[model samples]
Target: MPKAYSYLRFSTPEQAEGDSYRRQMAAALDWCKRKGVELDDKLRFHDLGKSGYTGANFTEGALGRFVDAVQAGEIERGSYLLIESWDRFSRQNAMTSTARLFDLATAGITVVTVDDGQEYSQERLTGPDVSPMLLLVVKLSQAHLESARKSNNVGKAWADKRERARAGEHKLTKRAPEWLSLEDGRFIERADRVEIVRRVFRETIDGYGRRTIVHRLNEEGIPNFRAGENRKRKPTGWHASSVAKILTNRAVIGDFFPGTGSTRFRTYQKEAEPIRGYYPAILDEDTYWRAQAVIASRRRVTDDDGRVVQRGAAGRRGSGVSHLLTGLGRCSICHGPMHIINKGPLPRGGLYFECDTARRRAGCDNMNRWRVDEIERRLLKHLTYIDADAILRGEASHGEFEKVESVKARLADAEKRRKNRAAMLEAVEDMDPDSLARYRELVADVTALKAELAGAEKALAQTAADPGLKARLAEAVDLNRAMGEAEGEERTAIRVRLAEQLRQLVEMVDFHPELSIIAHLKPRADVPADQVPFTYDSGNWRLELSSDSEPHGIDPDIFPEEDPDAVRAANAFFLKRRLAKAGGAS
Candidate 1:
C-alpha cells in the first residue's frame, strides 16, 4: 500500500463547511480504498475559504505549508497528493497550473485525481513525444478551462458595472446600511435606525472619535449592521472602523458612488453631486461634508519630509481598532511619526513604538521606543487630571480647517510651479539637443505637481463647503465632565473619546526640556497671524499656539525607567524635543 495525503479548498465558508467539503472527502477516501493507499489523516491540508486563482493558494496558503513539509523530507518520496480534480488544485490557467503540477512531480510526489483515478507521476508526465506544456494543453479538462475563463469574464463584468456607476446610471443592488432598507426596490431610511445614525453623527461632530463612538454604541447594547448571517461566527459587534465608515460615507449626504469588485463595494467621493431623490439622506449636506473633512484631516499627518504617515489597515485584523493614541506619537528629532513594534507571538507579546525614519535608516539619529500599554495608561491618567475649562472655545480654530489652509498654500505653490514648467515646455523645440531630456523631466514634475494640487484642492473644497458642520463640531466639548461622568470601565475608555475631542481643541503635544510636555492649542485657520499675537510662527501657522504644559503635564508617577533601552530612548527623545526653534518636530 502507498502513502497518500489530501488537499481541499473551498472559495466560501458555506461551501467549506457544507456538502462540498463532505463530498470532496468521500471522493478522496474512495480513491484511497480503490488504490489500496494508506491515507494519512494528519497530512490532509485544508485551505478553508481560500481562493485558488492567486498563486498564493500553493505558495502561502495551507497547501503551501504542506509543500514546506514535503521539502523538509517529512512525506515519503512516492506519497500521493490526492484531490478531486484539476480545478480543485487551482483555478489558474493551464500553463501556470500545469507548471505547479510539474513542481510536485519533480519533487517525487504523485498527484492523484480521485474523481477519475488518474495518477500523475514523474515518469508518466515526461515521456517521448510529450512536451509537458503541450500535453497539459491537450489534456486539461474543460471544467478547469471554464473556471479560469469565468474568473476573467467576471472581472470584465465588474469593470462594466463600475463604468456605469461612474456615469451615475447604476445603483448598487446589494445590502444597504441597516438604517436603509430596500422597500419596493427603493431605499427608505428606517426611523429607528435613522435615530441611531443621527446620534452617531452628532457625537462624531461634537468631538467623539471612531473607537469612542463604537464603545458608546456597544455600551448602549445597539445591534450593528450585518450584511449576511453565519451560524459558526460570533455575534456582530460595532467596530470603530465601521463607525468611521458610516461617518465618512457620502451616501449620508445623498451622494453615492457604486464601486466594483467580487463583492459590490462602494467608494466615497468628496465633491460628487448627490444622486437627487434616489434615496433620502440621513444627514444634511453640511453635516455630511463636515464629518468627511474631520475624518480626512485625522489621517493627513505629515512628517518633517512632508510625507503622509499611513495609519494601520483597519486595525489588527479581527481585533478591531485599538485605542486612538496607538499610532499618534512622533519622534521630536527625526520628525517622522512613530510606528508600533511588537515582540511577535513569543513568550511575552510586548508592544512599543519607535521612530520610523531611524528604523528605516533614512538618516536621523533619534532612536527611541516607548511601551504602548504604559503610554495608554498615562494618557488616561492625564485626561483624569485635566481641567475642562482649558479647552478654549469661541475661536474658529476647529482643528479640521487649520491644517487645510497650510495645505492650500502648498497647493498654490505647486500650481504655480506646474504652470511655470508648462510655459518652459511651450518655449522649447522638440528637435533641440536638451529638449527630450528636459521634456521628460518637466512632464514627470508636472504630473507629480498636479496630483499634489488635486489632493489639496479636494481637501480645501471639503473644508470650504461646510461652515454648518464646523459650527456643530465647534460646540463646547467637556472632556473632564465626560470622563468624570463614567463610573467603571467607561471612565478608562476615555482613551479614544477624549482623544477625538482633543484633536480639534489641542493641536499636538511637544515634549520639551526637562521632560516637559507642551500642549499646543490650535488656532483658527481664518484667524489672521498679525492679529493673533505670537512672536514665533510654527512654520507658516497664523494663529498663536498657547502652551498649556506648565499646568497639565505627563504625570510623574506614571514615568518609569524600565531598562537601559528606556534610558537611552528617553535621553534621545528629550534631546530631539528640546532642540532650538529651528529644530525639527515630528
Candidate 2:
C-alpha cells in the first residue's frame, strides 16, 4: 500500500461551499481507500483560515509545517503528498511554486493531485522531456494570476467602506465592548466611563503634573480600563506619557478611526491618517487645543548641563526641609529644585539652601546659595511689619478687601436670581406655551446662577472665614516675638511657618553670591511686590526701610564682604571636624 499524506486548503468562502472541514476530511479518507493508500491521521494537514494565495508568507501553519517536514526527510522517500488540487496546495508567486515543486521532486516525494490526476516525481523527469512539467507550472501560474485579481477587488471594496465611514456614515462592523454601545448609529459614551476619560483629559490640561494627576486619580479609586470585569484596577499612579496620550486622544472629542484591517489582518495606522469618525465627540477642538497649551506651559527641570534629572532622584536630600521648597523654588539656570543643606555640626547646625541646577549643570552663573537662618530672621522681621492690627481692623489694602467683597456680591446676586426663578417656576402651571418656555429658560439660568453662587460663596468663605488664617497669623506673631526673645526649638517652629508662607508667594529663592545678592525674587507677576511685605537675604533681621527696600538690617556691603568660597570651605571643614569628634567620642 502507498503511504499518503493529505494537504487540504480552502482559499475562499466560495471554495468552502458544502465542502467544509468535515466534508473535505471525509472525501480525503474515501480517496485514500479507493487508491489503496495508507492514510495516517497524524500526517493529515489542513490550513483552514490561512489563504493559499499568500502561502509564501505562511509560517507555523499546518501546510507550512508539512512542507518543512517533507524537506527534512521526516516522511519516507516515495511517499505520496496528496492534495485536492494544484490551487489548493498554493497559488503563491511563480518562483515560489516552482521552487517548492523542485524541492519535493529532489526529496523523492511524489506530488499527487486528486482533482488534476497528475503525478510529479524525480523519476518521471528523465532527460527533461518537460511537456508534463511545463503544463503543471502553467496551470499553477494561472491560479496565482486569478488570486491576485481577486485580492485587488477585495481591497477596493474595503477602501470604499473606509471612505464612507470617514464621511460620518455608519456601517456595521464589530459591536463595541459590552459596557459601551452605539446610539443613533454613532458611539454614545457611557456616562460613567466618559466622565473618567474627561477627567483624565482635564487634569492633563490643567498642568497638575502627570504623576500628581495619576496619584489623585488612584486616590479617588478610579478603575483602569484593563482591570477585569469584577476586579477593579485603580490607577497605580499616572505616568506622564499616559497623561500625554489622554490629552492627545481624538476619541474624547467623539471621533473614531477604524482599525486598519478586519479581525484576521488587523493593523494600526498613524493617528493623523484620514479615518472614520463614528462617535460623537465629548470634547471640542478648542478645548483639546487649550489642554495642549497647558501642557506646553509647564517648565521641566534639568541639570547644569541642560540634562533632565528624574524627579525621584532630584532634591532627595535635606533634613525634612526640602519638602517645603518642592514646588515653590527652582534653580534659575537649570530650573531644578533647590536642595536645603545644614552647614554646621549636629546640635548647632547652620542651614542653607542651594540650587541643584548649579551643582549638576557646569558653568551655571546662578550658583545661588542662601543662609537658612538669615532668611528666617528677615522673614520674621517682615511678618512683624505686616501689622496684625491692619488685618484685624480691616485696614488691609483696597485690592484685598475688594476681592473678598466681590465674591460676596456675586454669591448674593446668584441667590437672589435663584429665588426669583423659583417664584416664576411656581406660576408655570397657569401659563401658556410661550410662558412655559420662558419659565424653563429662567429655571436653567437660575440653576446655573446658583451653581456659580455656591462656588463664589466657597471661595469667599475660604479667604474670609478660614480658620487657617487666624491660626497662621497668630503663629507668625508668636514666631516673630520668639525670634526677638527665644532660642532653639522655639525659633525652629517660627522658621517652619515662615518657610510655609514664603513658599505660597515665592516661586524661587535664588542665592547669587557673585552678584552679592542672597535672595533673587521671582514673585508671582500677578501679585504686586509690595503685597508680599517681606525682603529676603542672608543677614541680620531688619524691617524694610520702605515697602520695596531690603528688609534685613545688614547693609548691602555685608554680602559683598562675605565670599561664597570661604563660606562653603568653612561649612565643609566644620562638617569634617564634627564627624571626627563624633568618631573619637564613639
Q: Give the top-scoring candidate (TM-score).
A: 1
Per-residue alpha-carbon lDDT of candidate 2 for residues 369-474, written as tens digits (9 for 90 to 100): 6665565555443342232332222232223333433344434434554565456557667654633554565556557656754664455444544323322334
Each model's lDDT comes to 0.57, 0.54
Clashes of each: 2, 9
For model 2, the superposed segments whose C-alpha errors exceed 4 Å read 10-19, 42-45, 56-60, 125-131, 169-180, 204-249, 258-260, 265-272, 276-278, 285-586
Q: What stretches of model 1 exceed 4 Å from their correct place? A: 129-135, 141-144, 163-170, 210-242, 255-280, 284-286, 292-525, 535-586
lDDT (Cα, tens digit) per residue for candidate 1, span 453-514: 46655664565444333222112224433544766555544434444545544444443223
Clashing pairs in 2: 214-238, 253-281, 254-280, 254-281, 304-360, 304-361, 305-361, 368-511, 369-511
lDDT of 2: 0.54
Provide the TM-score for each candidate, comma-separated. Answer: 0.55, 0.45
Residue 487 displacement (Å), model 2: 30
